[model samples]
Target: MIQQSLVLTGKQKLAWLENEVRDLKDDELLICTIAGAISIGAELPQYNETDVTDCNPVYPRETGYESYGQIIRMGKEVTGFAEGDRVLAFYGHKNLGVVKANKTVKVPDDVEYRYALLNTLSCDAAKGVLKLQPQRDDKVLVTGAGTIGLLTVHFLKNYMNVKHIDVLEPNDKRRELAHELGASHTYSKKEQISSTYYDYGLECSASKDAFHSVLNSMKHHGEVCILSDGNKDLFYLTEDFYEKELKIVASSDGWDYQKHSQWFFKETVKVPQLSKIFEAEITSDQLIHCFEELSESHNKPLKVLVRYL
Candidate 1:
């Protein structure tokens, strides 16, 4: 079948190109339409074609991941899932494709496809939250109010039940959204935090500066969990690091599927507002224009869902 997929050929421009896909294998499942995420400004560093060298710095020449789709066809070996089942997978932004059965998880019938598309991110946030292990009364500061940051805030408040939650975000829209998501206080920057110290800090901004800000705000022997991935190097003064006896840890995409499933089910019930963060939904045909619009918009979109149908 002829399938359309969105490929990032340049820095921020996406091309909706068509290609042919083969039939599903016995151990594979055929996915129909789904939603995927764009990592243009996050993982992909902006650069001109003139800068290309033997380095080939870009790890993924084509970008896009985090997809959830309906199972149009299932292989004979697939036991848990059937045809027409809604499943979430680590697939790209392709309109149709075959994915190994083990890599896909069936989404609950009650959950929306957009919300299911966030399965990977939600899992990542849950893993980070689990690692932080914040106490109920701890004053927790979450840096960055982006999707992951806000999701971390939601999990901290709802899942962990951490009462004193604060968020630091430069964007006004995101800061406000953080407030609505259960942050007790919100600041435009770390310097604006009224509290002198926090028991724990969840650094989600992926900015080296933000990481340092959180580290500086930590109390003696305080813990800070780094959640975002960035290219910049982080440096801390020897005196400050020793004086505070700070502990820092990093969390990333590796999440146990069983734990993720449990967290997803529980958190989704407690925080239905989690799905509200997605601001825009565009079809595959509008992929290029959507990225352009998002690149130009100053307000900053929280989560933009690319729909394929």
Candidate 2:
């Protein structure tokens, strides 16, 4: 678990440890981000105990995963990296962290620190592609147009090359971005989401209604890849899947092989096979999950990336 490795873990094991502990109580730390992504997409449901919030709890202090600034105390055993070395960690959300050197991917010096700050989102993007590996002529529809949603589109567009691709998102801004990137067609939930057509559906929005929407959008006996790492609305999932005979696939965790090969450590853009994921990360800060000058920050965007000082 040194500076340039990735780790696979269940939702969160020691979440309570990341709570508002007194500074004196806090001891023994390595690299960690100031914030991490708590929300996967737009319009999510309330979390239940079973939902298993990520390493950090929910906001008042929602974690911003993008642009994470790592901190290491005076003394810590690190391998292949130094005190000032910039690194990326998935546990950066809600200021959550773990003693995970394996999952920490170091940012290349040539890359912007903010771009390395984007590695966490790239993890989410990579996980989405791993979860939903579309085949030829698979008419695909991605629900939501937020960070994960658009990145899901990127993976499917650049990697999968499905017969047709679309996004069911309500946000005007997001829908526009989806089109700019790769969505063949973008529709709001109110608009016609096709009477019935689609082989695969990805629900990244985590909206209460998205489950049913995917079910109804499918052409029967279709597969819906559940990539959103957020809590699922039980009532919605149960009712839709039972009524529609929908096939659901819940895929979590990223690729172990990619982690081992230093996918994150290498120059993200230079990785031709993975250029789009990094492209999504590079554009992520200015483009997606944008927070305006508003009253509260969390409810606004899909993910927030900040410039670290």
TM-score of each: 0.87, 0.65
Q: Candidate 2's error at 41, in angstroms?
A: 5.2
For model 1, the stretches where C-alpha displacement exceeds 4 angstroms are: 39-55, 58-60, 194-196, 232-239
Q: Can you give the lDDT of residue 140 in candidate 1?
A: 93
**Regions more than 4 Å wrong, model 2:** 1-29, 32-67, 70-77, 91-98, 229-244, 256-299
* Model 2 C-alpha lDDT per residue in residues 243-291, reported as the tens digit of each score: 5577787756555523622555454454333222222221223222332
lDDT by residue for model 1 (4-92), tens: 77666665655767878777789999888666765433533332222222235452355466777888888888888888988877767
**In lDDT terms, which candidate is top?**
1
Report the backbone clash tally of model 2.
14
How many collisions per candidate?
0, 14
